[model samples]
Target: MQDTPSFYYQGVAALARSIQVSDKNSKFVLYMNRADYLDDFKFKKTGVNIEILQSEYYISDVEEPESFPGSLYTLDVIKKIAQAESLDEYIILDPDCLVIGEIDSRFLERHGCNIGFYKLIEGADYQFNKFPFERYGKDINLIGGEVIMINTQGAKEICQAIGSITDRRGLLTEEHYLTVIANQGKIRYCHINTEVKRIWTRMSYRNCADRDYLYKIIHLPAEKKKGIPRLFDKIDFINSHDDLIESIRYFTWLKESVLLDSISKIYRWTKNFRGRA
Candidate 1:
């Protein structure tokens, strides 16, 4: 709605890349604003059954949480998916996220336990966002909304929780709601800190953890425009995860300096132009 969903193309690239790394039985759903979002997508893999989901906005009255930075009606989207699909396992990934290795299996189990989330356990003050642990209480773990995993039973529970809780905190995010749930001892989780790490962008590299090349999924929130497009463009062609790791390692290579930005952009433009041929 707002700004035509800037990351829509990333969704296209994300779907294709996920398909590239996943197995035959590992099906996918590419949720977007329109059915033809992929019309401009350059790469097409054979036998990839990508189901496009264009769900009606779940909350008719509540506009997207505008005050919260980078926040959408993410809970609403997850709710829509939960109600629509009937997968044995349910995982919600943001467009900025990329699959690591064989995700289907690692995603299924959380520290050898089923029906748990891949949690980024944050402290009272994590990065710069000092969590309101007072509101949710202490000793309860908080996780990021980038990558989430839950079973059918857990998804069902979260679906119901969203309907009632999503509209409660106007300035708060769904990530906060996840914290509330954990504080209430509603769900189980795992220390998947290594499995899914948010790659620190130039804007927020100070908060970034030590880079782990073997992560199950790389969640790039702020590093989208510079890295995701180039990395994803490669996936349109046949590539192994090994081919992507080097690119992932140097995600901010394009933004090293003013001159490098220009050169990288030109190189990407040329690559795009040649691909158009």
Candidate 2:
């Protein structure tokens, strides 16, 4: 490890702002490919160590030719942070994720073995979900890409293993990279059980929950609250916080950015056209 111990998140200035609050001590680095955008983030006043990753690092070798710029950029940053920190272990958290409570370090202590992750799509659903999940000529264990904890060794192995598959024509995703390495016996993945209330955080889009409104402004209809359990009210209470709102925005941008971006593009593309149907 050559650099200071740090946490890494790539993308907008908004994400860095959210991360600054949740992970106050760890260094934060933002990897922006666009220089103009890079200048915009200069005054975000992100308290942690903030540096923009160079774009050249995102290029894939011949083997992984189809690398998506975004995924490759993230991978490049992860490798850079892991190597720079020489950290025994480090976390890669989605900026949109709000830390309601402290993480379970003990959960990560079970390191050499698989660490916690959400389940991937089942084989039966592969035909429908494969376009999103299957990558790099291998089946991906559908896990949340937002938060990952890795020891120095695990990080090193993941970095090296991913580098070998230069042809990303199939596996152009960060989560699938983990899946590919794990299936190859190069690494083990711990499956995080969603039933356990606090072992992990949930992705709203995956669960079909509405994901707008600033975290500080969840306006539950008073009528709807009547039949709801006290627990439900509690859930709403926590969700209505400024800090949490910022964090969720940060995490959601990177995790759902592609989906959101695609939707925006489609909407824009169709705006000028008339539909006969």
Candidate 3:
């Protein structure tokens, strides 16, 4: 993890560890506003290279770009990357994701697929309630903005749709435009559910009973604040020893989630009490 807790560094750390753990070859291009920000983050991978692309815009946060550079400019950044690299296909992942299994394997490639989008909750409609999704919006499930697999052509079409959007009914989010574009069917897309999951640790909102090991990549969006840092430490310990146990990821996820959620609740409650007192 980096010196500051404000920015989530767990996903980056996990990505670094994934390089060491995997048998197959893998490389990464991390998009960030400042490259020097990762100087303190010690990556232990030897053969695989992780390239950092200095970003023109901060697209980490969707709702709050002023407070934190959100994902409003995500489409533009991805489109630029695809063009610059002349890539046939690429994966766009969030900072809150962890790769548990295979990612870069040749078998994983979608030959004809334009955009391969992962949906966390299968069959659940209107994931982002605020945004009025253009078509098939109510019927279609959420397309997570976390893990996106796109080719250059697909990237251009998505970006065009995003730019053409006049209806900013809700907040500006990548997923909103994705939902709209997905319905158009102009670009071929696959809604992948099992391999990628956006898990909520809170009991009420939890998507699954446990963090299933079958998932190749897990999107822990809730853990950015507290759970991720703790999980990051656990991953560091496991990776340093070359254990690379898959089940550890699940166990650590459950334990940290409960503890951190409690801490967050207490802190919020205490702050509210102090305000009253």
Candidate 4:
């Protein structure tokens, strides 16, 4: 399962294509803000079992300084989908991720815990230690949210905990809450030495395959680069194996041009107007 905003349609296509080539038996579900933004014509012939679910926008009355509105609600959406569909377990992936190789389901099965997630590599501090370390002690490991395997029951507990939070001072974002849970030994943390790896920071594309074990899934977080050309190059490199990346590159280039952006916006507006009429 993956959650994607409409602006990252190309990433969705790349993810779908990667699954089609690598893990054909696995089900691929996409959760998006707007369902209509998906162009069915592009994926109808691909034989990929893709399901698109429209997630409800979460509106919070409380003024949050650190977290964005509807940001923390993603977990709620995942929990609702799992319960409504009677799913035993589901892997939640960010839209910008690609499955380059086969993901072994047996590796993700949990015995005692309800949740599984990737822990940051040992001895590699990425400066995510803003939480109160005194509460969790110094031996706690920080987990990444880019890819999470959740059990419906445990997720419900996490959601309840999130709802009970009145003070948002120490906890900055959803990742922090998840880390806290992992620190308490509430969740199972997957190691980086396995087939799953995360690229937290921006790095050269050539270094992606330099790891000891071949990574099955690659999580690319959204990072803002200085120049348009450099950013496009990085996007192209990370998604080098997928042809769908070209579309993303083209759309990005279009967004960089003022005239193209204006024209594209007008076209979308007119199309929406015609549909209403």
Candidate closest to the true structure, highest lDDT: 3
lDDT of 3 by residue, 191-256 (tens): 666567776654324444344546777676666666656656666465531354443444445433
Question: Model 4 off-target regions past 4 Å?
Answer: 1-7, 39-62, 68-70, 85-88, 110-112, 122-125, 128-139, 160-166, 185-193, 200-209, 222-277
- C-alpha root-mean-square deviation, each candidate: 9.6, 11.4, 6.2, 12.6
lDDT of 2 by residue, 82-115 (tens): 5764534455654333333334544556544424
By lDDT rank, best first, the candidates go: 3, 1, 4, 2
Scored against the true structure, residue 248 in model 1 reaches a CA lDDT of 63
**Comparison by TM-score, 2 against 4, better one:** 4
In candidate 3 the C-alpha lDDT for residue 87 amounts to 53
lDDT by residue for model 4 (1-277), tens: 1343333454555566666656766777765455564553254433434454444435343665544455555665555654654445666776566666767665546345556667765432335435556665767767776677665665776666555555455565456677876666544545533656754332211112334124777665533222222333344344334443343343223123445445656766787799999
Superposing every Cα of model 2 onto the true structure, what RMSD results?
11.4
Error of 2 at 12 (Å): 4.3
**What's the lDDT of the predicted structure labeled candidate 2?**
0.44
TM-score per candidate: 0.68, 0.53, 0.71, 0.61
lDDT of 1 by residue, 40-119 (tens): 55445633345544444333333543345335456656666556555466566777777766665555553554345546
Residue 93 lDDT in model 3?
76
Candidate 3 segments exceeding 4 Å error: 1-7, 44-68, 85-88, 104-111, 120-130, 133-137, 169-171, 209-211, 240-251, 254-277
